[model samples]
Target: IDPRKTETAEIASAHHFIVPGSDAYLLLAMLQLMFERDWVNAGHLAPLLQGVETVRELVAPFTLALAQERTGISAAVIEAMTEKLVQTPRAVFYGRMGVSVQEYGALCQWAIQLINLLAGNVDVVGGALVPNSAAGYVKPGERGAGHFNRFQSRVSGLPEFGGELPATVMAEEMLTPGEGQIRAMLTLAGNPVLSAPSGQQLDQAFEGLDFMVSMDIYINETTRHADYILPPTSALEHDHYDFAFHRLAVRNTARYNEPVFEPEAGALHDWEILNQLSQKLGDHKGIDVKMFPAPSAIVDQSLQQGPYGKHNQRGDDALDLAALREHPHGIDLGPLTPSLPQRLCNEEKNIRLVWQGIADDIERLRIASPPQQQGKLLLIGRRHVRSNNSWMHNSHRLVKGKPRWRCLMNSKDMHEHKLADGDDIVISSRAGEVQTEVEQSDDVMPGVVCLPHGWG
Candidate 1:
């Protein structure tokens, strides 16, 4: 269910128009009803799950009546949805930016996963399945024990995750004075100016940088500020293989794409540019600058040693990279299989459902309240199929026919404010304000406005 009458929502069994930023409460209430009705998958969950009692106690305060008031979703609807979740043999709760961009985002995400696990849906067919890739990437060790934080950000003191600080602090690090201040930055395929939280703040921060280098395909809003803009070869000119997407695919599949066209003279692939830059910087201890120089060689080696490799001496069921090369279309591996706690559990083969991080955050969620709208419309972002991002706005084919950038306000709201279609309206938030043409539509929920993201 979603707040907006989006294209996806039109075909949904039911569309719930929830109050913005109240996802956590709604989800918690669902879990509460599940527990109260005794509809959980006890047998499957009893063996692999932990912290059930804790979660049950944590969500006790979030009754259906309270949830109805907070989420603007009727108690009957909440109960019906919760009943559907429990009655279904295999179900998964999937949420995107609607749940992520609000307060208690992390809590809502954790709660969704918890609900799926309690329902015996995780790592199973027709449920929340895990992808099995040929590449056996080593899983990072446990946090706070094997992977400890070395330092905190100077400005916000936010602890680093996976040896990297949050991108939201980039502007502060550049503008702040003191030791270890960031004076220069090297960005790769990132448009933080448009994608980041505050575009105005990031624009000022980019202006303040001593030196900046950007590796991008287009001279867009973010790259225009860079002292040196290194454009990489287009996707059509680069040999492509799926690395990250394969690991997240719903079904098992493998595909390789040879360059469709040769790159222009003197143009370098993204990998080559980074390799050459590393050599120039005098760091060549472990890397072989000469060996496996091109992406094709790297792909061959990775596939040869990967799970589908014919050269894999470990098993007879191994696959051959040559077979894949012959089939230029693609190779379908098949549907998701059940690879449960054994394939994904910790070193001791145990799933720790309750963590210190989640436990501490529950207290915060207990007292959490939605931000006061104060008679102002809550602003949210939307995406169009034609526009990939701000960069795609330059494409004549994509931006042709009609304008796609406009503030979408509910018809009731527009009529109440004495505004007409195509009238310019000023939208102001604590971060900043922008004046844009208004489009009156019932697709958006009342007291909320929708604006497409990545627009300059």
Candidate 2:
């Protein structure tokens, strides 16, 4: 479900128009119905689950009626969908940007997992399968394998995730005074000024930094303020492995690639630049650059130690970097299978159905009324294939299409506001305003408007 009639929605068997920020309510209501109808079923995973009863109690107030009121989706529709979920075999409920980037993002994620669990689908055939990814297969009970809250941002006390503060907090961390203040920055392959929350604020925050270095190909919106720009070899000039994204693939697969084109003389790879900088900064202030391992070596080691690797007793069938390299396309590691209790990172080898933070967040949603939509259009972001990446602005071949950066207003909304297609208009919010040409499209929900996300 999405505010706009996306292409995916067009091809979908069913599509529901959901208010931009109210998906958590729908999730909560679905859980409530599942509990009420006694449809809660985790199958074999029941033994590993905890706090089902507590979740039931917390979600009681977020009934179908309440969810309908909040999400702009009808009560009957929500109820029917909930029933369908229970009746369907091996059903899975997944959400993306709409579920996240909302007030209850973390809560929504927890609820989605809960829905899959209660549907008796976790780690089962035809259901969600936890694959032993060759690129990133962490063993069960591995220390620090999904740990959280070890520390927080020094300025706003925002909890850190994987030892990194949220991008939303970066501006505040730099602007805030006193201890642990940010005086320098080293940006790499990111454009926080245009992409991050409170982006305009980051513009000011960046100007105040004592020293700023950017390791990027383009002096785009974020990197323009850098005192020094380090241009590294492009992806075309670098050997790559899908080390990060392969873990997220639906099926287990391994692919290794060699650079099709060699780098020009006097050019440096990103790792080489970083290594040299590390050496210049001294041992105490930087990583041991002299002993730094190349990315290929790391990938080789990971493959060697992996399940399908040389270390495995599986003989000739074992996989390694060399074996992966043999297949220029990719090696299919086979379909996803039930790797459950072993797939879990915790020593408990169980899925806790509850978290105190989520419970409290649900309470807030229960008491708080949905934000009044009258006289206020919910602004949603969109992206096009041609211009989604700001760095591609310089690519004439990619950006030489119809202009995509325009305000898309629902036809009814345009009529009510006495505006027309191609009319120059100003979109305003509590934070700020932007001027863009408006285009009428009945494809969007009446109270929702959209703007392509790119280059501020």
Candidate 3:
């Protein structure tokens, strides 16, 4: 189910248009129904899972009637969707950024995983399974509980997660005056001025930085403020490997791509620039800056030491850098199979279904009411296949045809405002306002509007 009649919804077997930011209520109602009807796979999940009862108790109040009232979806449709999920042999509920940018995003994500686990779909064929990469990159070891809150931001007191602060508070950390205030900033391949929540505030904060460096290919909105801009070699001039994406792929596969063309005379690779900067800072103890003179050597070492490497005892079936280089196309490692329970990397080797952070967020969801819909229209961001943010706007091949940047509004709302298609209108929010062209269509739900992201 989606709020917009997107291309995805057009081809769906069923489409249920839900109210904006009410995903948690709908998911909770489904879980409550599963618990009431005993449709959960209790035997298979009992040994590897925890906090089943806690989730059950927490979702006890989200009945179908209440869910319909909040989500604007009918009770019968919810029941049918729940029935299909329980009866289907393999089903997965994938929630993306739309569910993750709202107030109860954390709770909504937890509920999606809980539904997959309870339905016995985790790690099963055509189900939600953990992706395996041939590169043998094991999950990092767990840390003590105290490690999480060891340091908090000086300005907001927000605790760091995994030794890093959220980017949302970066402007505040720089703007606020204190002993630990950020004065110097280094940005790499990020246009925070357009992507951040408050573009104007970040633009102002960047101006006040004592020293600023941006490592990017283009002098876009954010990089224009940097004191020094370092341009790196283009994609065609770099050897490539899908190091991170392979860990999230549906099937196991490996490929290596040599540079298609040589880089310009003085252009430096991203890693080379970073290595030089590290040397200047006098902290190159364990890096061995000279060991791998080129990036291709690093890829070779990783492939030689990976899970499917020639070092394994699988005889001729094992693969190595030489074999991959010879193939040139790719080496397919076959489809996804069951690798649960043993694949889990927790200290206890079991799923901790009840996280304290998520449990606390559930309380916030329980008492939360949907925002009142009156004259105000809820604005959400969208993207198109032809665009990859502000970076791709310069390519004439992608930006040719017609302009795609406009305020998408519902036909009913456009009629009420006496606005026609392609008319210029002003969109205002607490942060700022922008004047843009409007297009009236019924694709979006009433009382809702859409704007494309990364537009300058």
Candidate 4:
């Protein structure tokens, strides 16, 4: 379910057109039905589940009619979807990037997981089983309490997740001067001016910094303001590892990618440049980059310390960098097996359905007014096939055709606004405005429009 008919929707057997930021409400309504109809089947999970009663109470006020009013979807459709989820054992609820970045993102994500738990679709085959990842975090009886709202940002008082504050608050933190004010800035691997919410605001905030440095290969929008740019080896010149992605899979696999090209003499990789910077910053006399371990050495040591590693010895045969290198196509360790109470992160070894901090937002959702879409169209962001989030568009072969950045508007809205297909218009929000050409299409939901990312 999404605000737009995305490419994924084209292949889906059905698509549910939900309002831009009302996903949490729809999810709560479905959950309400699950409780009222006695459809929740957490058979084996009963002993390990907590807060079932609290979650039921939390969602009680959100009815199908209320959800229909907030979301553009119908009450009957909501009921049918809930029934399907409870009846299908293999069906799981997953929230993606779009929902996770909305105003009610945290609530929507929590609701989705709670729904999956109630449906008994977790940890079983074809369900939501956790992978036996390269890391040892998912072992039985291990505490996996991933950090959340542990601390707040200095200026906005916004909560930090995993030690980093939200990018939305970056400009404000830099622009608002006082104690702990930001005077110098450093950027790595991102062009926030084009990819972040308040692109123009961030661009202005960069102007006031005393010094700024960027670590990137291309001098794009955000990096253009930096006092210095540290160029690194291109993609082909670096060894590759999927440190961020393998943990999300259902099958455990490992692959080490060798660099495609030899590095030019005296050309430093990213880590090498950072090591040199560190030495200079610390004023360490005679410290050399040779003192540090190479990136591959660190990876190799980490692999040996993993569950299948010879040093770890948690499993039978030894698996390490050598084992991975023996098979070029990549070796599948095994399918993810069920790891329940052992995988629970809490001291009690249970999964709590209700988090009071997140549940508190349910009431705010109950009374919140539907978005005002009368004189305005909500803007949604999309990525072009030829470009990633602010990357890969520099290649002429990928950008040789017509301009990929255009405001996609529903044809009905174009008719009411008296706009031709190719008319140039200025799109405005409180943060900033951009003038771009409009393309009429039925793919976008009415009262909503889209713009492609990665374009300056």
The number of the candidate with the highest lDDT is 2
The TM-score measured for candidate 1 stands at 0.92
Error of 1 at 22 (Å): 1.0
Instruction: Report lDDT (Cα) of residue 265, candidate 1.
Output: 94
Candidate 3 per-residue lDDT, tens place, 311-391, comes to 546578777667788878888888877776766666687888887887777778888766777788888788867776566
Query: Per-prediction count of colliding residue pairs?
Result: 1, 0, 0, 3
- Ranking of candidates on lDDT, top first: 2, 4, 3, 1
lDDT of 1 at 190: 87
Model 4 residue 404 CA deviation (Å) reads: 0.9
lDDT of 2 by residue, 1-456 (tens): 788999889998888989888898899999999999898889999999878888888888888888888888999998899899878887778778767877889999989888999889778887777766786667764456554678988867788777777887899889999888998999998888887877888989999999999999888778999999999999999999886778777899889989989999999999989988888887767555464788898888888887888776658988888888899999998998888776776767878878777778888877886686779888988777787746567688988867678888998999999998898888777656778888999779989999988645
lDDT of 1 by residue, 252-292 (tens): 88888878999989999898888788876655476545422
Per-model RMSD to reference? 3.0, 1.8, 2.8, 2.4
Stretches of model 2 off by over 4 angstroms after superposition: 283-290, 389-391
Q: Which wins on lDDT, candidate 1 or candidate 2?
A: 2
Candidate 3: C-alpha RMSD after superposition:
2.8
Q: In order, what lDDT does every prediction score?
A: 0.79, 0.84, 0.82, 0.83
Q: Which candidate wins on TM-score? A: 2
TM-score of 2: 0.95
Error of 1 at 165 (Å): 2.6
* Distance from true location, Cα of 410 in model 1, Å: 0.8
Per-residue lDDT of model 4, residues 75-140, tens digit only: 999999889888986888887888888888888888888788888887777778888766443554
